[model samples]
Target: DVKVTQSSRYLVKRTGEKVFLECVQDMDHENMFWYRQDPGLGLRLIYFSYDVKMKEKGDIPEGYSVSREKKERFSLILESASTNQTSMYLCASSFPLPGLAASSYNEQFFGPGTRLTVL
Candidate 1:
């Protein structure tokens, strides 16, 4: 079965601390994405990578960065943790469908998410 896993299910950090959120997929997907979910703002994309060593900034990438050093793993880095940065972080992976439109859709498999609390 296809599986996506995060390094932690819960994390706590102090202000100004550097945080690392790791994710791994066993499906050999071509794409990986990082998203942060907030109470009212909903899910916002932080970054995404289409291939190994290639990444693109998504909607909200200001305080966040991503690394996809290998095809099966993606990492989200928070340069300096802050209370405002606390949220649920999600990692997803997908591959383009052969018959579907490029911009239309791909079935993404998501991890359980890491709930981070910045103190």
Candidate 2:
């Protein structure tokens, strides 16, 4: 079975503090993504990596970054935390299927998510 796990289920940080959110997947997926969920804004992608040491900016990548030094581990970094950054951070991984449409290949498995609160 495939599983995704986050380093923490909940986190609290003060404004201007550096924050790191870690995620691990056991399924050996080729793609990993980081998203932030808010009340009304829905789920917004922060970053995604298709291969190790490769990353691409997502919709809301202003203050966020990601690292994928190993295939099974991905990390999201908040340079300096802020109150506006408080939200549920989710990590997802998916195996890429060859010869499949882009929309059909994204069968992502998600972690339990880490709820971050910045004061």
Candidate 3:
């Protein structure tokens, strides 16, 4: 089974402090993603890596960054934590299926999320 693991299940921080969230996937998948879940906006992608050392910024990458140093590990960094950034962070991984429609092939396996609250 494909397994994804995060560094924490819950986190609390003061505004302006640097925060780091780590994720690791047991399956050697080529794509990994980070997302934040909010009440109304739903899940918004933060960053994603398709290969080692290669990353793409998602919709809301202004306050966040990502690092993928190895195949199985992906890290998300909050440069400066803010109370507005409090949300549930999720990590997901999936294999790339060529020639297959995303709806049919790219099913992402998710990790138990980390809920972060900034005070």
Alpha-carbon deviation at 74 in model 3, angstroms? 0.5
Question: Which pairs clash inside model 3?
Answer: none
lDDT: worst 10-residue window of model 1: 95-104
- Any runs in candidate 2 off by more than 4 Å, and if so which? 99-104
Model 1 lDDT vs. the true structure? 0.92
lDDT of every model, 2 decimals: 0.92, 0.92, 0.92
Question: How does residue 83 of candidate 2 score in lDDT?
Answer: 95
lDDT of 2 by residue, 2-115 (tens): 899999999999999999999999999978999999989888999988879989898999998888999999999999999999999999999876643672367899999999
The number of clashing residue pairs in model 1 is: 0
lDDT of 3 by residue, 28-119 (tens): 99899999999999999999888899998889999998999999999999999999999999999999776435622788999999999999
